[model samples]
Structure formats: structure tokens, C-alpha cells
Target chain A: MRAVIAEDLALLRDGLARILRAHDIDVAAAVGDPVALAAALEEQQPDIAIVDVRMPPTFTNEGLVAAIEARARRPGMPVLVLSQYVEQLYARELLLSGAEGVGYLLKDRVSEVGMFVDTVRKVAGGGTVLDPDVVTGMLTHHGRNQAMARLTRREREVLGFMAEGRSNAAIAGKMVVTAKAVDKHINSIFMKLDLPLDADDNRRVLAVLRYLQTD
Target chain B: MAREDADRAALRDVNWRMILRLEASISVGIGLLMLIIWALAGARHFWPAWVWFGLAIPLALQVAIRRGLRAPKGHRLLAAHGAITCVLASILLAIWLLAGARHAFWPVWPILGLGVVLVGHAWVRHALPTAREQALADRVEVLTRTRRGALDVQAAELQRIERDLHDGAQARLVSVAMNLGLAEELLSKDPQSLTELLAEARSSTLTALADLRTVMRGIQPPVLADRGLEGAIRALALDLAVPVTVGGEIPGRVPVPVESAAYFTVCECLANVVKHSGALQARVDVGYRGGVLSVAVRDDGVGGASLAAGSGLRGVARRLEVFDGTMTLTSPAGGPTVVTMEVPCELSSPRT
Candidate 1:
């Protein structure tokens, strides 16, 4: 897959580009600052865009804005956002646009090269992959909600993995449970959340996120 | 200024001494002349005694007035009044005795009038403050309050830093150390788990670094040192989700303590803009004029922001209070929010 990277730090930007290249992913353009990121996204039209939450000219959330704008210009355009810190508020804002083909992770996750590469490829393939930290934050925030209060302990655990864009098999592997048990847990979670019983994993993930996003 | 004041006081003292010496010499010369006149005119009826008493009374009154004038300002008026009244009363009583002790006691009336005047003079002296004194009192009150607030904020900040470090990086490092020890114990026996343990240790180390960085940033941002307030704020503006237009010139650097307080205040306001205000754009204007550094952050967002909400803005306000700074928030219900903060400070020359 072809990707474009937007990171202000030269070290991190080169590091990301090098990592992706080693993973056999082509980095079409790697640029610093939001203005250049916007131009590169427009010109390259790469399969995915990896962005930092902070970049020039204002280092606050320009990268997040650029990614949202990129997706707005091209709906479902895959984008992975990385930051030193992951705020639930920023995650909510990012998901508000659309959950599909989006990934928000902390920069620390890049140390896990295998997982980082997998997440990038997953996002490029139009999957929703949120950082576990972001998922944990969301769960803590919404834990007391009426719908969330109805979830069993095991079901809540399953729901967290689901929110992190894990497949049933992957969730089963992590939980050390059989695939059938993981499937049953997911079905129960969907029912408790009052979501439709969607069979597609990606759609199911979106549905679960939509339910979580509600007040 | 001290040297000039000392010189002026010395000159006044010399003048007072010269005047006293001249008065003394003149009185002696007059006394000698009177005695000579009495000795030459056939000594009888002792009328020269009256002349001597009259001259002594005026000299005594002059000395009293001069001394009263030299007294400190608050007591000067009262002292002068008392001195004049005493001299006048004594002179009147002497005249009464010299006039063969009047039976009606007429001196009491004049004495009563002098007492009333002196009382009024004392009242006036204590009742009002001079402009300089009033200003000084006001400045002392402000300094006392701000100094206490500064100390309180500083104490609280240090406590928070300690708590954060203890719970965050320090705890993480302990975990990392434990993981390393475990890996060492399982080095050969469970080589399979050794890699996992090492990875966990490395991850904890990274987390500790992140924690340390956050704490360091809270204490003092490196960017703030590299760029002064204006430049640092400009850098901050670049990081926001909405485009922020930074205007005005600061000319030079504000004192570091005040600058940090102001910068954090601006950061808090901007954070509110991002979280609470659904504004499309924001702007920061900074300027220094009339010895006050002014910063105003305005957002075209949903308003209704208030300090009473117990938001972080209240903490920011308290922090600014330590520097004798002020914050004003104007956020109407419909749209547009403006936060203006001003600190009285002087800017130093820009660092080369």
C-alpha cells in the first residue's frame, strides 16, 4: 500500500517512512507541517495518510484537522493519527467525522513495530483501529451510562477489544478463549448495546463505536 | 536620592543653628544695652526688668516655632499650634501679673480660645493622609495580598509536581526495574518469556520518559525559553485545531515568572476554546503599553463560558493573581468569547 506521512519532527518522520518502506509499503510523500501535508494528500492521493496530532504552523491539532479535512475531501480515505498523548475528546472529534478507515494511536505504540505495521495496513484496508488507551478512556468515561451498566464484566472486556477494531478470532486469541465463545460474547455485547446484529466485522465495529459515541 | 536628601537636611540643620546663635547673640547684646541704659539713667522703679521679660518672650516664641516646623509632618501642625498657644498664654499671664493680678481672671478666656484652636489643629493633623502616604498604604496592601497568593500557588505547584512524579515516572521506573530483574532470573530457564519481559521493561521505560516529559513541560516548557512570550505563544497558536491569528508586538521579554503565568493562562483559555467553544477560528493579540503587558484571546465559538463554573480558568486566574494580574471573560450565550488578561510589568531588553 502507498502512504503519505505528516510529522513535524524530522526524526519521527524519517523513522515512520523508513519503517513503512521496510514493511514493503510505499511512502509516496513524507512532509512536515499541515500546509505541505494538505498539498501532498491532494497531489499524491495515497492509499492512506499517517499524521501526527501536532504539526506546524500551530503545533496543537493541525495534523488532526488536516486528516479530518483530507477525509472530508475524500470520504473513507484511510488515515492513522499518532500523538504523544491520546485525549478522549480528540478521539471523539475524530470519530465524529467517520469511524471507518481511521486509526488513532499513541507515538509510544510505534515501538511495537509489528503491531504498528499491522495497524497501518489495517487502516489502509478501510478498517477502524482505535488505540487501546483511547478505548480504555472511553470505557471509563461511559462506564456509568445506563446502556454500558448493563454489560457483564466479560462482555465489557470483549467490547473493549471490539472497539479496538479486533476481529473475533483476534479477540479470542488475546482473551485465551475459543472463537465460538468470543463470537457469543460479541453477540451478547451487541444485544446489550441495542445495536443491530450485523455480521460484517467492520460494520459491527462501527455500530459499537456509534453506540459508544452517543451521550 | 538619599545623598541629595542628606545634603538638604544638613543645610537646614546648619541654618537652624545659625539662626539660634544669632538670636542668642542679639538677645545678649540687647540685654547688655538695657543694663547699661539702666545703669546710666539713675537705677529706679526697675522698668528694665519689663523690657528684658518682653524681649525674652519673643525670642522663646521664635525658637518654639522653628522647632515645631522641624518636627515630622504628621505632628508638625499640632506641635506648632501647641508651641504658639503656650507662648501666648505665658505672655498673657505675665502681663496680668505685671498689671497687678486682675480679679476677674481674664486670662482664662484667651486661654480657652487658644485651647480650642489647638484642639482643632490636632484634629486636622490626624484626620487626613497626605497623597504620598495614601499611595504607600495602598501599595502595601496589594503587595501583601499578592505575595501571599504567590506563596500559596507556589506551594501547591510543588506539591503537585511531587505527587505527579511519585505516581507517574517513579512508579513506572520501579515496574521497569522489576521486569528487568525478572528477565535476568529467567534468562536461561525460560528464554521464551525473556523477550516478552524485556519488551515490557522497554515499554515501561518509554512510558516513564513520557511521564517525565509531561512533568517537565508543566514546570517550564523548553519552547518558552527558546522563544519569549510572544514567540512561544505564536508557537502555541500553531498547534491548535482552529487557525489562530496572533497579532501585536511585545517589543521585549517580560519577567519569566509573569510570562509563565500569562502563557499558562493563555493555554487554559485556548484549551477551553477547543473543548467547550465550537468555534471555527480563534485569535490571540498581545501588546505591551503603559507598563502593562496585555493579552486577549477571542474565539468565534459558542459562548456562555463563566468563571463560576469551576473550570480550569479559575486556577489560571488564581495563578495570574499572584502576579497582580487580572482576567476578564466576556462570553455571551449565542457566540463569540473573549478573555482578556493584563499584568503590570516592565519588559527587559530582548536576549541576543
Candidate 2:
């Protein structure tokens, strides 16, 4: 899988390129700055673009901007953004646009190289990987607490399963209940949490998030 | 809170201010004397004048060294400016005196004294206020630091609440919820016990969640970050009973620290306006000027507000001082109270 890396620090960029290449992922172009990363991506379109949250010139969110630009150019290409800290607002901006095929992780996660690569691979395969810390921080907000309060104990248990990406059957099996019972629990959760009961692949994720937020 | 304690705090700030003024004025005077001596001594002969200039260099450096001394709040800048005047006056006075004062140079002393008269006049004009203002400034600082300390305590309380939810209440609730689900399934077998257990669990969950939400709101409001500053402040203004007209345009995105400071300042100002001022309306203005973020809160209330009374305004002054910012409160006995705070924007570009 070919990838373009945009990071402001030369040492980090080179180090990340080396690590990715070691994993047999082809590093198409490694640029120390986002402008060059953007130019390189235009010249040599890669399968995935890994960007830093901060990059050269206007270091604040330049990498995020570059990733957005690349996605704007090619909607299908996956992008991974790495940041130093858990910024809930930044993560929300990324998720609210669409959670599919996107990854936002802390730079400290790079120490766990295997997990970092796995996350990257997940994004490339059209899956979302939000930093668990970011998820926890966002859920800790006052509004989320209010929402969480409104959930039934059983519904809240189902949400924990759903947040782990479990299906209705999987959740029902875990709870030792019938699939119909699980469906009832989910419908109750949806009504209580006031979430849009839409039919979509990502609705489970949305439902889990809404449950986590309110109840 | 007592009269004696308030008087002592006022005295302490005044003492610091006096020391600042004295050190500044003396340094300037000595430097001036040195410059005059150097000029006269040097002008006696060009060769010796250079020697006098060399002698004045050490004194000039001494004055430069004094500039490094830390002065309290507004006094630092004033002290430094006063010292500067002495050095500049010495240089100009030396030239005028050495040249024999025969030409248009005599008027230089008046020009030099103009700065002294201007600063000294302003200094003396505000002399009664200098002590009170310095006290108020110091008090505001103390209050802000205390409030920040209170905030830290509040944040700690939040962390504890989070831990409590995870380890104490949420854990028990999870078990209760699980047991309730089981109880619901076996309701026909033991309807009475199952119903009681389920009811107990439901009450426990609701109480735990309510406690968690109350604690979390103190840390940060989700709406503030969600809808941005305008929404946050608008929400705040709505809560205020007194008519608070909030003016000034908020940027689409302000630095988090800047917004936090601005938010608290407005909150505190309105609180003060409500608690102390018998006012009809208060206005809070926030905007950026010359790369410095400015917040001005004005209340058309019965003023006579003094920071010496350990009013939280003193704390406000100190909080602003942390970022090299300032808070000025002007409250006349009968009318409007205007509190202005300005903070420098020192954004270190994160570039290689």
C-alpha cells in the first residue's frame, strides 16, 4: 500500500518513513512540510496519506488542512492524523464530517508501532480508529453526562457492547438474550437518547456514541 | 477582611510602590549627576571629555542594571520609564551645560523637566490613587490567584468525580443494570424480589448520573467548545438577572487560553456588578487590538468599589498579571464602573 507522509519534523518524518518501509508499506513520498506533501500528493497520488496535526509554516492544524485538501481532491483516499495531545474539538471536526476510513491518534501511540500500523491499516481498509483517550475525554463533557443519565441499565450495557463495534446478534449473544430482546433494548435506547434511528452501516457506531453521550 | 488586614495589605503594596519610585528616581538622579559631571569635565578639554564620557559609561551601565529589578504590577514600567528619563536628561543636560549655555541649549532643562513634571505630575496627581490603585491591583491579583487555586481544586474535584463514577457508582450501577436485566427475565419466578431489586438499581443509576453531571459542568461546559465563545458568553449573559449588554466581536477561533481568561473575566465582572453594584446595566466588550486581546466590562451602577476590601477584583488583577496582562478598575461613587483588561498575544509559531 503506497502512502504519503506529511510531518514537520525532519527526523520524525524520516523515522516514520523508515518504520513504514520496514513494514513493507511503500512510502511514496516523505515530505517534512505540508506544502511539499500537498505538491507531492498531486504529482504522485498515494493510496493513503499520513499527516501530522502540526506542520511547518502555520504549524497549528496545517497537517489537518493538508489531509482535508487531499481528501477533497480524492474522496476515496484514506487519511490518518496524528497529534501530540487529545483535542476533543479537533477529533469532533474529523468525525462529524464522516467517521469512515479516518484515524486520529496521539503521537505517543507511535511507541506502540504495531498498534500504530494496525490503526493505519484499519483506516486504509475504511474503518475509523479514534484515540480511546479522545473518546473518553469527549464523553466526560457535561452534555454527555446528562445523556448518559437517561439510559436504562440494560440499554447502557448494550451501548458498551455497541461501542466495541458489536452487532445486535453479537450483543444479544454476549448478554445471553434473544436477538429480538436485543432489538427491543436498542429501540428503547434510541427513543430515550433521542438519536435518529437511521438505516446505515455506521448507525450502530452512531447509536453507541449517542448512548454513551446521554446515558 | 478586617479593617486592619486591609490597611496592612494596602501599606505593603504602597511600600513596594514607594521603593520602586525611590529606586527609580534616585537611579535617574545619580545617572544625571554623572552625565553632567562627565560633560563639564570632558568639555574642559576634548581629550578629557572622552575620559569623562568613559567614566559616565559605568554609571549608565549601573542604571541599565537597575532596570532588571522586578517591580510590582504597574510600578515596573513606571520605574523603568523614570530611570530612562534620568539617563536621557543627564545626557542632554551635560551637552547643554558643557557647551556653556550660550546658545539655544538652555531651554533643554525645561524640556527635560517636562518629562519629570509630566510623569511626576501624573504620579503625584494620582498619588492618593497610586497607593489605592496599587493595592487594588495587588488585591485583584491575590483574588485571581485564589480563584485559580479554587479552579484547580474544582478540576481535582472533577477528576475525583470521574474516578468515583468509574470505581464507585458506575461500577455498582453496571452490576445493578445487569442484575436488573436478569431479574426482568425471571420476573414470573420471583416477581416481588425482582421488582424491588430493579427499582433499587434504577434509583442508584439516576442518582449516580446526576452527581456526575453536576461535577463535570464545573470543569468545562460542552456548549462553550461546541458552539464557540459567543454561545458560551450568551449562555452566561442569559443567566445574569441584571441587564448585561455584551458588545465586541469574538473571533471565529481564539486561543483556548485567551478565551478561557476572557470567559472568566466576564463572569466575575458580571457577578461583581450584580452583587455589589446597584446598577441598571453592565456591558462586556471583548476584541483584539494590536495583537493583544482586550476585555472591558462596564457597569452603570452605584460604584464606590474598592479592591482593598478583598473584593474578588483584586484576584482578577492577579490572574491577568500571569500573562503579563493588566486590569484597571475605575468606579466613581455615584456612577459607572469600568474594568478593562488587556493581555498580550505571544503565540510562538510552532515551526522548525
Q: What is the DockQ of candidate 2?
A: 0.03
Instruction: Estimate, for each residue in B186-291, the C-alpha lDDT of model 2 and write its tens digit.
Output: 7889888887777677666655654464444445554454444555676566456575667776455556665566566667788888888988777888776677
- Most TM-score-accurate candidate: 1
Using all chains and alpha carbons, the TM-scores for the candidates as numbered come to: 0.55, 0.42
- How well does model 1 score by local distance difference test? 0.84
lDDT of 2 by residue, A89-172 (tens): 565556555566677876766756776787778678766667765555433332335666677777777766655344679789
- After aligning candidate 2 to the native by TM-score, how far in Å is the CA of B230 from where it should be? 9.0
DockQ of each: 0.04, 0.03
Expressed as tens digits, the lDDT of each residue in A74-126 for candidate 1 is 99899999987766556766887788888999898888898899999988987
